[model samples]
Structure formats: C-alpha cells, structure tokens
Target chain A: MKFTVQVNEGPYQHQAADSAYQFTKAVLEKGHEVFRVFFYHDGVNNATNLTTPPQDDRHVVNRWSELAKEHDLDLVVCVAAAQRRGIVDEGEAKRNSKDAENIADGFRISGLGQLIEAGIQSDRVVVFGD
Target chain B: MSEEMMDDEVVKKMAYINRRAPYGSIYALESLEVVLIGAAFDQDVSLIFADDGVFQLKKDQETAGIDMKNFSPTYRALEMYDVEKLYVSKESMTERGLSEDDLVVDVEIKTDAELADLLDDQDVIFSF
Candidate 1:
C-alpha cells in the first residue's frame, strides 16, 4: 500500500519526529511504499540542517536525510510552516537576502497542495503528533 | 480487471482525529480548516472528537474577551459541505461533565471501543 505520513511537532522537543521516522522506516522495511513524509506545524524543524545536538544524542536531521537517500523517499516540509519557523532552502534564503540556507538534504519545501495531492494519490495517510 | 470495475473504485475512508481543545492552541482550528478544504475532494470523510477536543463543539463559546475570533459557528456549516460524520467520545464528555446539550452540533456519542471499531475501518487517519 502507498502511505503518506505527516509529522506535526518539532524534533527533540517531542516524540513525534521519532515516531514518524520509525513508522516510515518500518513501513519501508515491510515492503510498503511511503508516498511522502510531510512536515507541518513545528514538524518543519526536522528539515533544518543547522541543529547541533549533544555528541551522544541521535542526529535526527541526518537520520531523515539518510533514510530518504536509502529508500528514495519524498520528504516534504510545508513552505508556510518552514518560513514561519525560519527553515529555509537555498532559493528562499537568496530571495529573502538571508546569509544562509538551513534546509537539510533530501527534503524539499512545498505548499499544502502537495499534501492534498498525497491524500488523493495514496491509499492511506497517517499522522503522528502531540 | 474490467474497465467498469476500475472506473467505479471505492473512495478511501478518511478520518480526522481531534484530541486538543479549541482556542488554547491552533490544532482544533487548523484541523477544521483541513476538513473544510478536504471536503472539495469528495472523499469519504469522518471526524472524531476525543479528549479535550470535545470542548471545540461546546455551545456559547465567548471569544470577545480573549480577542480571538470565535469559530464555533463553523461547526454548523460543516453539514453544508456534506461532512456530517462527527463522532464524540463519551468518556471524554463524562470526565469534563459535559452532555450533548452543551454541544453546538448534533453528534453520535460512542465509547472508546466503538470509536476504535469505527477508526479501524478507515483507510486514512489525520490526528490533530
């Protein structure tokens, strides 16, 4: 089955990102297709490349990037949400004249239309959040 | 498969789960916004109001003092969008000392088990 996953909270601060990652990984391991993993609300924090966690802590941002690379996954961060929280891509940073871009590898910033398209195309849409 | 079978495929069951109260945070209102936008897709949609989420449908919500827009009236307009499958958790309402009379809209009250059964049949569940 094709599934679309949505995460609604930030990484580290909440268990939502971890659960969403685990769920996505498990589904892929079971030979199911993940159509897209949409990061909305504070969930867009998962796509920032600037987070520098303690040495012992899991690198949540890198984990998502690697997973997407391994499975050829579509990791989408909501543009509206990302902008609100200052998670920007190269183009956005350039457009807004910011010094740097913080979007992680393997994640693309898009509109809510992508989310709606996922709902239309996927067999199931599962959400993880507080 | 026959062309007729392919063309007449069944629509996926979509469930919108609400577990937060309105006004305190943006979840309840944002969830409602998604539901309203999703109505245009014509999918099989159902809504679940659980935990403090039951407060979202409470009657006579006064937002004037808080300086926030009171969106309780949107619940009544849901029917116009053909999005009528609203379910409220009986346990949640009882714990909060609220009855159907306190809600602004009519809803089918179900126990956790019953609600679970309903959710099990859904193809998709968007929890807010």
Candidate 2:
C-alpha cells in the first residue's frame, strides 16, 4: 500500500515527530511504499538543518534525512508552516532575501496542496501529532 | 478536476482525528476546514473526537470574551455536507466528565477498543 505520513509537532517537544518517523520506517521495512511525509504545524521544524543535538541523543532530523535518502522518499515540509517557523530552503531564502538557508537534506518545502495531493494519491494517510 | 470526474473515483475511508479543544489552538478549526473541503471530493469521511477533542463539541460555547468566533455552529452544517459519521471516545468523555448531553451533535459513543477497530478500518487518518 502507498501511505502518506503527516507529522504535526516539533521534535523532542512532543512525541508526534518521533512516532511519525518510526511509523514511516516500519512501513518501509514491511515493503510498503511511503508516498510522502508531509510536515505541517510545528512539524516543519523537523526540516531545519541548524539543529545541533548533544552526542548521545538520537538526531531526529538526521534520521528523517537518512531514511528519505535510503528509500528515495519524498519528504515535504509545508511552505506556509515552514515560513512561519523559519525553516527555509535555498529558493525560499533567496526569494525572501534571508541571510541563510536552514532546510535539512532530502526535504523540499511546498504548499499545502501537496498534502491534499498526497491524500488523493496514497492508499492510506496516517497522521501523528499532539 | 470537475465534480463529475471526482465522483467517478473510488471513495476512500478518511477520518479526521480531533485530539484538541477549540480556542486553545488552531488545529480544531483547521481540521474542520479540511473536512468541509474534503467532503466535496466525494470520499467517505468521518470525524473522531478523542482526548480533549470532545471539548470541541460542547454546546453553548461563547467566544465573546476570547474575541474569537464561535465555530461550534459549524458542526451543525456537517450533516448538510454529507459528512455525518461522528464518533466520540467514551473514555475521553468520562475522563473529562463530559456526557452525550454536553455535546452539540448526536454521535456514536465508542469505547477505546471499539474506536481502535474503527481506526483500523480507515484508509486515511488525519490527526489534529
């Protein structure tokens, strides 16, 4: 089955992001296709490349990036939410005249329409949030 | 796509899992918007009220003091949109001391295990 995962909370602050990541990993391991992982609300924070966690902690952002890279997954961060939370890609940074870009690897910032499209295309859409 | 074309597509079971109260945040209201718009796409949709989400269906909500519009009435319009499958968590209601009488809409009250079964039947689950 093709599944789209929606994450609606920031990492560490809530278990939503972690649950979403684990769920996605589990789906992929089961040989199911993850159509896309759409991040909305505070979940957009997962796309920031600027996060620097301590050595012992599991790097949630890096985990998502690595997973996406390994599975050729489409990781989408909502543009409206990302802009509000300061998670900007190179294009958005240049367009908005921002000093630096912060979007992490393997994630693309897009509109909410991508979310709706995911729902339309995927066989199942599961959300993890607060 | 045109409405006629949309009607030809396979209908998927989708549920909007409301887990928060109204006015506290934007999730409740936004989820409602999605449900409204999604109904037009001709999918089999339902709303699941769990945790603090049951608070969103409480009757006699007045937002005058908070300066926010009272959207409780919007739930009433859900039926008109053909989006009437509403389920409330009995455990959540009991936990919050809320009964069916407190709710604005008539809903099927389900236990946690039954709700889990219903969730398992869904093709899509949107939590907000």
- Native contact recovery (fnat) for each candidate is 0.28, 0.28
Cα lDDT of model 1 by residue, A1-130, tens digit: 8889999999999998899999999999999999999998889999999989999999999999999999999999988778878999988998889998999999999877677668767777888898
How far does residue A125 in candidate 1 sit from its true spot (Å)? 3.4
List runs of model 2 lying over 4 Å from the truth. A90-101, B1-8, B64-70, B77-81, B89-120
lDDT of 2 by residue, B1-128 (tens): 33532444767788889999998787898778667767777778879999999999999998999999999999989999998899999999999999999999999999989999998998777879
Structure candidate 2, residue pairs in collision: none
Model 1, stretches more than 4 Å misplaced?
A: A90-101, B1-10, B64-67
DockQ of 2: 0.27
lDDT (C-alpha) at residue B114 in model 1: 98
What does each candidate score in C-alpha RMSD?
3.3, 4.6
Sorted into a CAPRI-style docking class, model 2 comes out as acceptable
Tell me the fnat of candidate 1: 0.28
Candidate 2, residues A29-105: lDDT per residue as tens digits? 99999999999888999999888999999999999999999999999998877887899888999999998999999
